[model samples]
Target: MNPLALSIAVGDYDRTRPLASGAVRIDGVDPLMIFLTPEEIFFRAFRSQDFDVCELSLSSYCVKMANGDSPYVGMPAFLSRAFRHNGLYVRTDRIKTPQDLKGKKVGVPEYQITANVWARAMLEEDYGVKPSDIRWVRGGVSQPGRPERVAVSLPADIHIEDAPEGTTISSLLAAGEIDGFMAQKVPALGPGGHPHVGRLFADPAETAKDYFSRTGLFPIMHLLGVRRTLVDKHPWLPTALLKAFTAAKELAVGALTETGTNKATLPFIEQSLEQARALMGNDFWPYGVDANRKTLDAFLHHHHAQGLSKRRLSVDELFHPSTYETFKS
Candidate 1:
């Protein structure tokens, strides 16, 4: 019989492209890949369980898992990772330093989003700023009144307010209504053409590199997940999918290492590759529990501390047991 066909939705990341392009194949499954924006994937995946397999926001995933209502089980194939310092934007005249954010108004697309969680973690852990220090305003980055996908009851000390009915964080920043914004994508109008909007870190790339040099955390943002019912019905599917994703990542790394010409559109692909290698060694982006335990643990700690996760989850609980071991080649 032909393998089961599963619909998988995720970003069109280079590391995941091999699977999408059919260069890598699951052992007992036929994946129908749909490339969508993270927002679309996360909302549909979490709110409606729209796909059989999808990339899930690590923070939101934990929330559902902690609530004992998780519809999906994790596969250790992290599809997205990055240091979030670059995602922190602020009004140039109002918020100059991380310390300056104290007692200021900070905007987020969603308070429970993984990127915001990590960015807040960096602020409190590195600087003296606590999550409660700033009054958090939750809203759409470009639109208004975006609701948190998962239900979360925050700690008593943290203060989060909803944005006004018809205004966005970009508009708030442009008008100086909010002091800063932390999001995976900076608000559209708050940068580029706007003089008042700028990143909190002057040279965000350099700052991210410096932070990584000290912490050794690439900051995973998303992981692949399979609907729990599907996993229950097809017990072998998780392991098979994990194997395919690992192979796809290997292919992506090989593509990055080619120096004949630029593999990506960026002008500094070669230089960036060299820098990454120097800092993180050859296999910078890794899969599996052992390779990402530190980062995972840190994120879990923050997720619980920020009240996104009802319970602190161990790294072992985050992934399916089937993905723990791979067969010998």
Candidate 2:
């Protein structure tokens, strides 16, 4: 009856900080939490199954899940979530709107990354721009010669071109080689740099707000994944993970609400939170299977439609059975 020790790798987010610092602990488990960049975590996780527990790209998970090649089963912790409207960058000279992207070459660090899938969903569902509508240019965002962390076999209709030998997508977009680019991590192009390089949506916040009002989806980017071997051996592990991450998030959120001193060093924390609560309600960033079913389903449809997943993966198939429900007191 010894506490099982595990190595967990994830982002250095406020919600996950408690787990690393031991402010929150998983039931009957000892965790060695390693906060890492999403890129590094995923690159290692998919390639070598690096960590016992890790944050994973939802798109890549589905791609592997549908192919029946995944080594991990997902936990609905959803450590990372974002609108992704801001992920897009475009040249003002050529692209006027999302519609303008049709038949144009757009750059993506990886076509199957979660953010790009959500961005593509926004373009296709809201405006009628399918994934096949634009010729996709695949490359690095900041550096050169980066490839997809997990190779995906896209359908015939969807096309991708490797970025020229030594060029990064940021440079290509700046040079007008690609009409638009999905800049995952912001490239160093701002005031006094590449005058024409700008965001596709001038005010992406408002655009995202409008999108949420219509779609009810605040897109999920990453999920906690447990190695399937571990899950099969320790049947209680997934729910223990769920309980720990949920508590960590609540603690982090409580700090934001404390008016005496700010836990996060940002201006107008109170007012900003008020606006967020008004839009998405108290439990805005919710966890678990039942809560995020719509968002999950939408992502599954997008993943399948865009040819990333061979078939649409159901929410049931994505996680362990114990995680799908929790014991009620």
Per-residue lDDT over 1-329 for candidate 1, one digit per residue giving the tens place of the 0 to 100 score: 89899999989988888888788988878889999999999999988999999999999999998898999999999999888999998999887789999999999998998888899899998997999999999889898878998889999999989999899987888889999989999687833558888899999889888889899889999999999999889899999999999999998888877878767877878888898999999889899989899999999999998888888889999899989999997
Off by over 4 Å in 1: 190-192
Off by over 4 Å in 2: none
Error of 1 at 194 (Å): 1.2
Per-candidate TM-score against the hidden true structure: 0.97, 0.97
Model 2 lDDT tens row, 1-329: 98998999999999999998989989988898898899999999999999999999998899889989999999999999999889888889999999999999999989899999999989998989988899999988888899888878888998789999999888888888999987467655545768888889999999999999998998999999999999989898999999999999999999999978888888899998999999999999999989999999999988988888888788889988888777678
Error of 2 at 248 (Å): 0.2
